[model samples]
Target chain A: MSVTGPAGFRAAGVAAGLKASGAPDVALVVNDGPSHAAAAVFTANRVQAAPVLWSRQVVSDGRVDAVVLNCGGANACTGPGGFQDTHATAEHVAGLLGVSATDVAVCSTGLIGERLPMGELLAGASAAATALDAEGGPDAATAIMTTDTVSKQSLVEGDGWSVGGMAKGAGMLAPGLATMLVVLTTDAEVGPEELDSALRGATRVTFDRVDSDGCMSTNDTVLLLASGASGARPDPVAFDDVVRAVCADLAGQLLDDAEGASKTIEVEVVHAATEDDAVEAARAVTRSNLFKCAVHGEDPNWGRVLAAVGTTGAAFAPQDLAVAINGVWVCRDGGVGEDRAEVDMSGRAVTVTVDLGAGTEHATVWTNDLTADYVHENSAYST
Target chain B: MSVTGPAGFRAAGVAAGLKASGAPDVALVVNDGPSHAAAAVFTANRVQAAPVLWSRQVVSDGRVDAVVLNCGGANACTGPGGFQDTHATAEHVAGLLGVSATDVAVCSTGLIGERLPMGELLAGASAAATALDAEGGPDAATAIMTTDTVSKQSLVEGDGWSVGGMAKGAGMLAPGLATMLVVLTTDAEVGPEELDSALRGATRVTFDRVDSDGCMSTNDTVLLLASGASGARPDPVAFDDVVRAVCADLAGQLLDDAEGASKTIEVEVVHAATEDDAVEAARAVTRSNLFKCAVHGEDPNWGRVLAAVGTTGAAFAPQDLAVAINGVWVCRDGGVGEDRAEVDMSGRAVTVTVDLGAGTEHATVWTNDLTADYVHENSAYST
Candidate 1:
């Protein structure tokens, strides 16, 4: 179960002729709710996709009746015609569900700089609406995938309600969101303001901390829909916790399925003057291609880590920095410490700890190692 | 002829057993000057190598008698002992040249975080000093080699004066300098102030614009020693032009020799609000791994180019950005224009031009494509 794990939600996934492999490329999730409260986050990239522009307006009023997503065409950089296509898709979906077009959100993923095949998409949307079921969350999760090898879904139960979500993405993962589409649903009775606040607080630390390849996408989206079908007015703090838990679980799945990644790296920055400084420092190290390659080779090359840290404007003296690979302190006081051979890196998970020795704030960024497969997959993706 | 192409300069190279391959790993360049006016620039990275710390102080007085450079050990992150080793090397070179140790500059490049073998380096310094000759510039250039396949040398002549320089680096090439050491000698009668100004201007547009993999090294040094042997003070503008020409030539060579790169990409950002905006836009494109990989695969994926440009704060509307690969405009007004198939990417030299449509300012940045060999080389370099 994904979005449909919560009550008062129905979802369906249908095969559209958009993807070359004939995989399911269209999904629909409708909120048959007593209350229609929603919140969303879009990609920070100024070159946003057609659907993102359409959906940003749809969710602006803090109410969303439904969300429709498609893979196999990013529909970005397609100009006015692309925007028209996105608008037409939302209108078509709204007509079938007896809702206003302004209440429907649209999301798209895949290659950029191309137009979508509207004929197959509209027919697929009709099929998805007809096949909507309360237990179709997994199918919806599977449909919104581009390079993802597996569907991502998570459910967090509160006192008498639950929060559930689904995510899809592989590459182009970085700060300000990635090439991922996430749809979250909750049965708790919450207002639009509370939903928006909870969603922002959750994603700021979860999806926002995942950096794969440091490539920001033009079609990233995350939406949360709330319905009062559970008749549970849970505490706002508990609701926020459940939302964050679901988001964290989905983010982890995205990292686990990152494109061509052989190792998952967690770059932890500690003892920073501020939380922003810690995040900045951690992100700098996570974005270092040299350091990622070293991790792939299983070499405790702390010099590359320190070099990356030196590139940031964070407050910390170079000589006061210390770094550890796994559990071994490979570098202390900015110099060689423990024997590099003692640090084992054969496992698929690697942790690098950097102590800035500045203050008490800290942050951890999730990333993946750079491999030849990553280069090969991305190089052959569009052409 | 390289550094020794000018008068009043002697250079020598010798094998010091520091390199396991039994290759030459030590070089000595002496300025037997009528006037020893010198200026130098080191890596901007705060975690600099010990030699950079020593050389920064040596060049503070605007005078340097000699420069001794070694390969096979960067002597970085080796604590106070590393600084002591650099000081000792400078002292040994100064003793041989009968000059103050403060006037002797030291440079090192190789694996970081390891102490250098001082015994072998000292002995090699003695050998290099004894073998110094006026025609040994090429030999000295060959000595300071790590992963570089070939030596880089360039000469630019003026009226009865010339500027000659040698450089060594193949990877870790990015803005704020790279993992390179450069020794430049000129027979022009110029003061230290003029030399410093000309060098800064020349390098700002030359070596500083080459970004390969976006990894800044801790051991980057560029030194220019002016010897008034020619007794010819050409126009400062002409002298600056010669220095810039030599630096541009060497920068080109570095791009050509970038590790595992099959294509040399020149990203030109035109019609920017300011020169800084142009440079920032160009550099963002150059540092994009996805764009680099697309170039490596011979794919005219203009979407990646625009995606990179969107990450910058440069003043440009999404609807006004246009990109041209080679001579064909593939994107116009942020949308697809010409057929991408019309843009040929079969050549080793690829040019990507982005028109911001904001102002008249422009800039160009040189970079290399990301490839499997690049990942392989960096992954296995230190292990």
Candidate 2:
């Protein structure tokens, strides 16, 4: 079977005994490339994971040939010892692939502050490298998940090259980007600079807008690798389109699998003074627990929405704002507008639209309604 | 059954049909004195409640003889209509007591935006006025609660005067004073200016430090009424001490009854460059969901705590920070210091200390653990 992205990458996943549940916890990705150009986005959180620190240095040279990812142990807050483990992991992967150590990237997820079980991880990495195959993308996707109920993979097939990626995270999802670990691989002939620009542009609207729970993580990393095997150097605009589609698809999967989520909420803020203001308004409402709870209960509580929006520093006269939920205009000119009973929210997707009546700029943020299951899952999560 | 505070004030509470639960919802406090002075602190949220707007104007005169409180609807975001409801509620109470409406302060809590059921509320106010007695303080406390599992009341008896207060709130609790609605009654013979100074000073360390969830509310208000009923004036220091004690006790109650809260966590930041910096650091960790969840699971996740502190805009070298959880020094000099396996978390109260190693300034913020129950309660709350 052909992998989703480019044509010259092989992937493999295997159980590494890192998770008590015995799920697939190790993945290896290798590029058969003309040029090993890569770009990565690490979590903006100051509390960096050991692997993220290692990967940041490796990607500084703007080239990479392989990525080694392990789930079920986020080697974060483990001090210098954890950094050594990440370095060893990268070195081992580089030796196996016969590449420079700096040409290998590493990622880890799961619990924080725990030392990586290096003995088991090294053995698993060796087994995963031996098991690598051209059609192992799905297995690799499955291996990177923790707490996520399903594997998240997205692909956008283009004329000469394709964009394919996978993401994992169910909670600790919020702006500046969710606590997601993502890897995008493509055979498209794009340089590191172009890839970096495209990835940042794509993520700003897609992954960066999904807030499951208003929490930032200590370990979130998104890496994009361009093998240039297809030898098709598309224009920046076309490359951006592919990146957008892939990011949009992955974001959808993340929301669909949000922890204890019953409904995926799309908050669209339009007619704002600027795109930043629009995004600010939408995100403020998205992070509001009262607003999310109202959505979960199928109550078109426009009052909560207005209250949430009013708290944002965005300048707007109350009478100039309009709000609608599920296509029903529930508030206009900042007061009650139509019958809230007209809203229908008995589905998995819900939409809230706010018109700032200030300017033409707009933004959209995605979130999930707070649910009892979310509480149940998180309250007992650590146990 | 004497009220704890002043000598010439009577208080009463009555049931109103505004709440679906049919709990007490109307409270009345009357000062039978010649001198009446009042001061208030409203929610910092820009989306002010109708009551807050009205009380702000009334308290501007610095003289109020009575405070009428009802818990059924927050009367927030009801637009101009909400302001009218607040006005009419105060007028009704004032008319029944044969006093000017300007001398009466009004407060409301519960769901936001919905108009109060005037027919039931007016009748309840009439009943509360007739039932006013010194022994009705506890009943008045019960009437103001929304989702609060218990009533919060405190008393500080001084040589010449006394301070007593009642507070209510359960969710949307965070710094900038939480979602609290408090009424502090004092018998101290002080001017409105002094009352204001003491109130602000007391709140800065007490109510301002309790952060249950990060969400701020639109209806939080704290009113302090000086009846001057005792006819005995005390020194400023003694009066301030009484105010501080009352506030601290009420703040403790608020944290204990926080929504979905099973344990109260105290985050103390010490040796900071400034008091504001110390408070900021403590509050940052208190508001972190990751840290709260770790505490909920009885996991001494000090790394999450340090990560939270690092994210704050406060300036501090990571290596100069020390962290202790539940009296166990978990990290010192920015790295692991104690055996994680030896720490204890078997109690419902947890204390976390962070030393910045900068100066002597210190601050403590109270918070509650994040649990599944919190998620469960909030997710289904609106329904």
Candidate 3:
């Protein structure tokens, strides 16, 4: 259920004064590795957090000793001082762990465009160092939550190795890696290159497709640390599959707990000209505020779906398109078909299947309904 | 003001049974002209409505004698029968006006994926033909409204000529013409080519930048007709300026009457490297749902603005970007700037200005705030 499920990780969560609510807001994950091989991905947004910039340089060398994550204040858009603050934090951790400062990855979340409480967070980091234990995964996950109602953690058992990860994001979730902060750990004997390849391949089909809010964040980062403490060389293909499974589990959890979302929607586009086309079609529908509202109201308004589809240039004739909501073919051949009244939408999970009838390629994108709660939660307060 | 504000035009509106509520749903504008020069622009969406397809063909020869519009059912995604419906409507109008069918332009709006009530609409068309009058502009404007709270009209006077137009749209309003149906007329002496250039120039800075809700329509159409009745061939530059002014007025009206909107936001991007860059930057901020809701709550969350700007490739360093809300520079040099609390946002109109600090080019985009009423109105029933 957590990154510590792997053999070579030690984690801790500590309450830092960085958060106004006085909740646990600092997390530390240490790879006490026999091998400190690592790979990572950062947010594609050009307006990145200071910590993301710091960690990008660390992971560039495919080696890391520790990761310090803080919530309550995103160290983003703070100019040069923010980057220096991140450097100081990493330097403090490097001092205690007796490792090079450049090997420590720093991650932060919460309100963007503000500086972190450097003094308080640094003190919390020192406390987390002494608090690290194998059972600290749950606490670590909790420390990284912003508006998330629950902590997200996943563990995948492999033949002779194991992969586990934790993610934190409740809003501003659109692909380029799920718009969140994630930390993954494994006990497999793998090189940094293999880990990078496997991580990218896994995320391409998993985290990269979860588009909850169509808004990307400034501090999204995913790190994979391979400690090789299990002393087992798992098959690369098998290891990649396990990593993907863990990522998928965490991605679904992110969507299920999306900010103020009541229903989790799965948009599947089939028979497209290419996988890219299928993704384009699915994303277009997911981004339609009108369609999202219709889904929220439990109205099988296939018309909104068609309007969204029409906005995309995916290779398909409008006349040949079909849309099925919750297994009811509400629109077929681009026209009304089954009685929409027959579709029941009382459940928390809903599926919209669009048949492009163009080619064989297909893809599925996950999203959430646009609810009044979403508007209220987003508008009533600043996160 | 409406199409008949131009001397050579006659207009009418009639209630049709096409709308479930029995609202006026049919409008006609005829050019009783010495000339029939016309220009039109349809939605760029590939999955166009049947009427859009039919009208695109009619306007290609650069002449149109009449325009018929209905706002009860969007003849979109209804397949071949929908095309036939638009064609029959055009032919019916052509016979009554003593013009070729190819010279009639048709427009439709309302719920998508449903067939129009051909029988009732045709009957309404006959009634509207008989009801035609020089004083029928306001009635015509009222007939072509869907969820719009008020009719949008604008009039611009030239030396001896005048331009008047009406627009209808409340949702599914995005670029590519704001998902609207509009008919514009001028008594100025001008040919089709000049009319096309002026129309395109006008709309590019007007309707193309009105991105309320960011859902492009499949049935958006705008027509500009010249009757040559005033016999005043004003300077081309002056005509272009007048056309742009009228378009800006109509675009503003559309924003004011947007469905369920509580605020009309004007986003102006300044000091960009190019006009295109300014537009891209402005549009990025307007599309951010988080920022829209913040504006709804009047939180003055300028961090969201910086986050949105960071997503674009516009030429400006993160540290060089500045954002102002309602004349208060809330974010300067990408960091916290003036006191956000100093800004007043109690009014229905709000303005956000971003300084890219790249060059002198600038552009402005208009949008509406996301509100609970919007979700309720769009979700409670399909339109």
The DockQ scores of all candidates, in the order shown, are: 0.82, 0.48, 0.69
The CA lDDT of each predicted structure is: 0.93, 0.84, 0.91
For candidate 3, give the docking quality class from DockQ.
medium
Give candidate 2 misplaced runs (Cα > 4 Å): A1-4, B1-4, B319-321, B333-335, B357-359
True contacts kept of 2: 0.40
Which window of 10 residues has the lowest lDDT sum in candidate 1 chain A? A374-383
Interface RMSD of 3: 1.7
Tell me each candidate's RMSD, in Å, in order: 0.9, 2.2, 1.5
Docking class of 1: high
Worst 10 residues of 1 chain B by lDDT: B303-312
- Winning candidate number (TM-score): 1
Tell me each candidate's i-RMS in Å: 0.8, 2.6, 1.7
Clashes of 3: 0
Ranked by TM-score from best down, the candidates are: 1, 3, 2
**Which window of 10 residues has the lowest lDDT sum in candidate 2 chain A?**
A1-10
What is the lDDT for B125 in model 2? 92
lDDT of 2 by residue, A198-235 (tens): 99999888888887877777778888988888888887
Colliding pairs, model 2: A375-B372, A379-B372
What's the TM-score of every candidate structure? 0.99, 0.95, 0.98
